[model samples]
Target: MTQDAKIHHHVPDAAPPPPSSRWSHAVEAAGWLYVTGQLPTDPDRPEAALPPGIAEQAELCFANLARILAHAGYGFGDTVFVRIYLKEFARDFRAFNAVYARYFPDDGPLPSRTTVGVAALGRDALAEVDLVCFRQSGG
Candidate 1:
């Protein structure tokens, strides 16, 4: 069987920015979807101001991640890993955890995660997150 036969592949329906940068943003290969850094961009308005607090920003970040997973035919249950970048880890960690708990209650097979303080983020976002998920197959 060909590689494609061995494993189905899927790319998200979202498109990259028109003024292409060196980054590809996201890519899917061999049933795994790798999402790039997702900021707290409002679904209704991409340029909308991210809420001015860490808790709100974290929630929005998750919201953005959910959209990407949904578009790629996956869900939070399929997430295998995550990486988070915080502009102020010390000040925001508590609030971040509070918001995180709501989405990841019961520690449901928590995906591997890494979080670190960052000097900056795109558009002054306070927090950003990315994820990797395995798409379920129906035979």
Candidate 2:
């Protein structure tokens, strides 16, 4: 962040964003916010158990991302791009898509997206997601 630039650091009140962590949940600069990848683990309670199945895990990942965007005064409607990671692509891709559509509906401007299959994720989470957003003026 520079002195003449308006930058915002966020820690999503809804999810709380991993207490005292070294990384920021989201950072805003020049009307854009770069959100960090969100795992299915509960940021509000690190010790809490994770949700089972890809559908639930995928939903949680989006929920966590939503909180980060909301904290920074943005939303999915502001999103320009999204990236998703899946641990079991063969088994869970369809289920993940179903959950993903609920949050990112086709009725609106769909953000450009990429979904990658991964061997594993932090805390053994089945999925993770991150976003890049452009905040519209007065929105």
lDDT, candidate 2, 1-139, per-residue tens: 4534756565745454555566677877777889989888776785688888988888788888878877788888899999999999889999999998888898988999999999988778899899999975567
The candidate 1 region of ten consecutive residues with least summed lDDT is 7-16
Give candidate 2 regions above 4 Å deviation. 1-8, 12-21
Model 1 has an lDDT value of 0.74
Tell me the number of clashing residue pairs for each predicted model: 0, 0
The root-mean-square deviation over C-alpha atoms between each candidate and the true structure, in angstroms, is 3.4, 2.5
> Best candidate, lDDT-wise?
2
Best by TM-score: 2
Which lDDT tens digits does candidate 1 get at residues 24-124? 44566667778877787676676567789998889888887776677666778888888999999899988998887777676588888899999999879
TM-score of 2: 0.87
